[model samples]
Target: MTIRPLPDTLVNQIAAGEVVERPASVVKELVENALDAGGTRIDIDLEEGGVRLIRIRDNGGGMPGDELPLAVSRHATSKIASLDDLEGVATLGFRGEALPSIASVSRFSISSRRTDDDHGHVLEIDGGRVGDVVPTAHPEGTTVEVRDLFFNVPARRKFLRAERTELGHIEDWLRQLALARPDVELRVSHNGKVSRRWKGESDLLSGMRLHEALGEAFRDAALRVDHAAAGLRLHGWIAQPAYNRASTDQQYLFVNGRAVRDRSVAHAVRQAYADVLFHGRHPAYVLFLELDPRRVDVNVHPAKHEVRFRDVRLIHDFVYRTLHEALAGTRAGTPSGAGVMPADNGPAPSPASPGIGGMTSASGYMPQAPLGLQVAETRAGYAALYGGLPAQATHDASTVAGPPQALPDSGDATLPPLGYALAQLHGIYILAQTAEGLVVVDMHAAHERIGYEKLKCAHDGEGLRTQPLLVPSSLAVSEREADVAEREAATLAELGFEVTRSGPQSLALRSVPALLAHGDVEALLRDVLADLREHGESRRVAAARDELLATMACHGAVRANRRLTLPEMNALLREMEATERSGQCNHGRPTWARFSLPEIDRWFLRGR
Candidate 1:
């Protein structure tokens, strides 16, 4: 082995491997440098996903003439002056390799001048070689022009995606940066035309405006979270329960004004949302965490995309608690147009009028709140509101009562026709005869599955059945649960649930789905409400619907342990044969597995 310095070209290419993974990476670095230099306005232009050209200009403090060349050299100065600075990184461009790495593999040119300077100088580097340092006229700031990215690396170029997809990546990165620095104006152009632009403005309203421009469904459901404790301040907007996407692309996270991904921060969010949302559904949030820079480490990666928190547990707990509180207060008010679940019946309470230290009735139906939210005063409030009431009053008046007065069959021709027939099982399962197979069915599972599908379709805007609450029942929940409920309101309404706040921490129960025949409305409400609290907003609706079906199926299905007559069994078998997808039950479990005569004989050891 020889220990010698590598060739300049080879070294540059190797560095490029880390700094330039895709067009988005280049944009991220350039834009970040602009921001670090105190740029309040930036413009980005791209062509063919940066394969042909990429240009970034920023109105920031620019480099002086003598410093132009060092800007493109590996491990150069600025950003970090000492090892101690590494311990508490605040800037986004500490690793000085980005410029050189990008320059080595592409045609790079930079024109920069200090804000006070009268004119800027242009410097060009082609394939890692300095071509010239000529004087040029330009506005105050810096502009870096990149052409033919990955030109010398054919293999890397081959990995580049289609132009549209590459552009999507670039757009996504720009949006993230825009979210982090809402105070900075950003303009992006691709293929010589303006594609995306954001005139950075402070405040949640401005952020929402940017979200609308991005067209990522960021505006559907948004929650404002602002809390401060023990030297850490958490502020940002979370998606309402009714607003959620099918992917993680909508989530924008920032820590101390720098956009970096920290698992601890994400986990805190997820944990806070646990039990309020459905599995596999993520909540959309643009959360900003502000704390002393000394409490975190940002020098973990060359790209500066991740960080390490000094007190991870504390951070997690703080975020979880803060969001949980904010959601609780917000959920107590009337749901917004975004389709948040209406508060249970009770006196309305807003974050501005948080009840002193008592868990509301809504809390009874939700997952346990964080210790911070379980204030003594809140507990007393919960006791005063619901403690002495009879069990039936606190639960549901409908349990002792019966179904809502069914109107005489309405002569409405618009209602679709439904065929109904039932064959009894060995006292448990039901066999329903249908055009398909005999439709041997698990009565409970089938009903539950049907209910879920129906609810989902309705929530998707295909159909809906709203059940109004006769008496609004107040529901008390942790802030996170409340948030989830708000996000999934439309979906819940589709399932025939009309939730509204009846009192502080109390949601009134006015109506329930007609299909959910005879069940404990109070219990069902508890389960549905709790699901929203655990999962994020996106999952909240699905969770509630699933729970409803689960309860329906449980009560409606045939009991497995019960015996049946021969006729009943035969009828059940016939119904099973007639059902669609009869092989599987609701919850995706197989309903039944058949054995042929030959298999039965084999089991008896009668095989010749």
Candidate 2:
């Protein structure tokens, strides 16, 4: 067979396959074009998830009358003049494939006027055929209208989802763009119903406006994170530790103002908060990474969403260290409040919460600052001065003030007393007498492992039981995330998530895993999807799912600090014994360790 050139229409349909995936893809390309044109404000109006109509108007530098026709021409762009410009590309978008690709599948119209022009000129394209250019009155910017998307291609049109699903996509796209450029005023309307809007500003808190647009549940989980390091700057907000959702709807990531899906950065964030947070419960964040353009490559994909950093290891380390240091008490943004100094030194506070002194509750934990800033550590002498602990004894007497809580010694109990048959220490670990010597068990670790396996097996055997949500939970999500959700819809359904796309940028939750009986299903879905969206590709999706299981196991299992009665303890022991891999927890830490009778005797000076 001889090779032949493809027809223009066929060429465009193929391009549409790559560039025009859904209603949201069209929105993304159009929005990015508007932003690249130096738009300070953009308005998007959609009907029927942009399947019926889409209109975008921007207040930015417009195009010349002659350029109006070229705007719909294939490979036409003012973003790059030549190859050299690629090295220093700083704009959010540089590809010229968007307009033509979009117009091929939809009836398209573009009207524009330079600031110096008397009026605007409108050029139309009906399924890639150019309509006559006509004079039109308009502002010194650009307004693009797209109608009857995928009309000529019935196959593509058939794949179009429900109106609700398409609208959800649109909603997600708009909000993420709004978050990326808070300095630009954005307003979105669908079918004449107001959807969302954001004012342009540099203020970090501006993204919080999404709470009003999206809802209070979303706002509560939101947290703010910002820090700068050597040549690399990180700025964004995350949901509070307690605020996590099941889906990845709330996560937004940007690399120099262009939205991205980079797992290295997201994993670092998760690792930084690992110890304190449960699995499955993801931290929702809108993170921005800014470094020299020379150090990053944004040309990896046609969409330009995937990037290759020159020093990914360095980037990873920087993100992890900075996030961890900020969350931990290592780096202080604010001065420590006045407090007593230790005459010399004292044992370090629990690793999880530091700088938090004077237990208000018996748990000895304290909340962070209101703005999500690191809590200022109380100084060494601080405890004495604050009368938190008696000066005579540095250690908190309450830790071991009374006799150890007694355990029942009934006929069911047995002791082989050439030495103590078993001795439980600190009420946290258990020691059992054995013919060889003795065995030690970390109750928390052991139970966690057992619970994790049970959950995994149940998840495999019987799909997650879904509990219906009383009110539909709505959230904004990126298009890539939407694709993942759609692709994994079957799996998600098994997990008890009855999620249907509601817009080009949003998702609606109708149900959740029934096992999460008392959980905030909407929030859980958001967090799960956020984690998947941010870190899914780099890390194994299965591993992330494991983390989710860990989260559920942690919440459902008995806590480490909680005191248990004998029956509860015995039941835990039996469960651990029956468990296949009971030696370690789901996180891979040893659940139990053994010490022989001789070792215990030596510690008591029975042998030297």
Candidate 3:
């Protein structure tokens, strides 16, 4: 058969295949359009889980009657007009294919009335057949109705899941939207009964909105992050390492107000939590990254759920460093104020409280000691354990002085976050009294974190140690990987690897990070090359180095069932307050937990 141009309806149906996957896809596109139109309030009414009918009304700037027909025409979009506009497009619905594509696959109607218009106009489309626009009465906004989704295409319709499943997808998308735009009011009704509602708030980053969307547990554990630098701004809430999840279901990332999935950002977050998160556990975060539109290409994916960054390395490093520094303040005894709950129907919780006591303030605390000096001063016993004989451990352990007999009362002074140690529980937990209540600490876990952090500081100060290969390892890789390895040789060297291109598609690894020298050098090189090629950087070397340091710290940490004096336990508590990321051990388990006076009172019925 001779090749010919596809008819308009067939062309539209084909485009629909790419944009209209299911009812949830339809909701995403239409809702995006509403947001782009400056909608402040959106109401969605769905029947049969949006499979039978979906009617969305938005209080936004409505289109003119004349443009109503053109709105459903292919490639007709007001979002972008030229190549330059396309390069820096910021709106969510710039492609303009959603309206026509969605119209072709379902029975659709759009009614709108601009604020200045005398009356409203409505346009209808039936399975790709356009109808004339007619006058109608409507509020000063826009309303879009879609029925019989995938009716014209039985194949696509058959692929749709059950009603409950489709509605779940729609609800999930709405939740993501609500997270990014707390300023927009969203209400949903399923089969005529209200299902969910997100009230608009003046503050976009309100903690109440977070609580409502993600639940109280996440809100209580969230650490607000807002930092701007180098033409990029990253702000959002990241759950504390102790509040990690088994899966990444709670991870939400939005770039420039658009929800998207970026592996580079995800990898950076994972790396930031590498030392504190338990193996196989995923950290939960709701982060928003803002950069110049020209620096990121959102048109890479049809659904606009993925993007291509102009400088992946710069982005990766920025995210990693910001989050890394933020998490460092997770030291034990720091009252983040994240655990405080707001009163019923009250204002959003206040920002995190400032540091307490004469110890280092959370905002100003920066570990200044290099490896040997700080460790020697604060943890001499652990150092002795690492170097000296086991018989000498007892002598070194006695060096830590006990607190004074007369401890300062909470009424008279601001106690340290962890308070004063009272006694040791079974030689494992350090029981202490705080201004608010009881503080229970896992001695081994707390010491492990302290030692791990100190070791990292020392390692960072001295730089990575490289072990030269007696016989250079030769590995064959893809041409792209080889090119990346050659281009990033200096970067590799910084990570303690000396890689050189041997052939068009081959590499020679002359040296590797000493910490991972015994591991699979070939596999390591391959993994590093893959990361570099995709993300413009790799953390495999650092991760491997940290693993070794973590093991060392674990062994050097105080073991359970070991006897400890009141002074020794108090000294350990003080060190925990000073150490960065001390709230969790090297394995991500929380090192301590606080039981406030009120909670304890309820447990014992003391108030009653």
Q: What TM-score, computed on C-alpha atoms, does each candidate reach?
A: 0.59, 0.58, 0.91
**Stretch of 10 with least lDDT, candidate 1:** 366-375
Q: Tens digits of per-residue lDDT for model 3 on 533-602?
A: 8888888888877777777777767788877665556666766776678889988899999999999999
Quote the RMSD, in angstroms, for model 2.
Answer: 21.1
lDDT of 1 by residue, 1-608 (tens): 97999998789889889879988899888888998899999999899978799999999989887799889888885988888886777788887889989998889999998878878999999888887788889888999999999888899989999999988888877777776777888888889999877877875454455455435455545656678999999886776534455677667778888887876678667755542454677778887899988898887776778877878757877887887555433321123323232333332222222211222222222111211111111122322211221111122323322323332232443211111124455544554332222334454443333323323333333233344555555666555545545656665566566666543445545677543424565666566666444332223334454455444434434445443333333323323332222233444443442233456567778857
* Model 3 bad stretches (over 4 Å): 205-207, 337-392, 395-404
Ranking by lDDT: 3, 2, 1
Ranking of predictions according to TM-score:
3, 1, 2
lDDT of 2 by residue, 426-449 (tens): 767766544546656676676565
For each candidate, how many residue pairs have backbone atoms clashing (under 3 Å)? 89, 56, 1
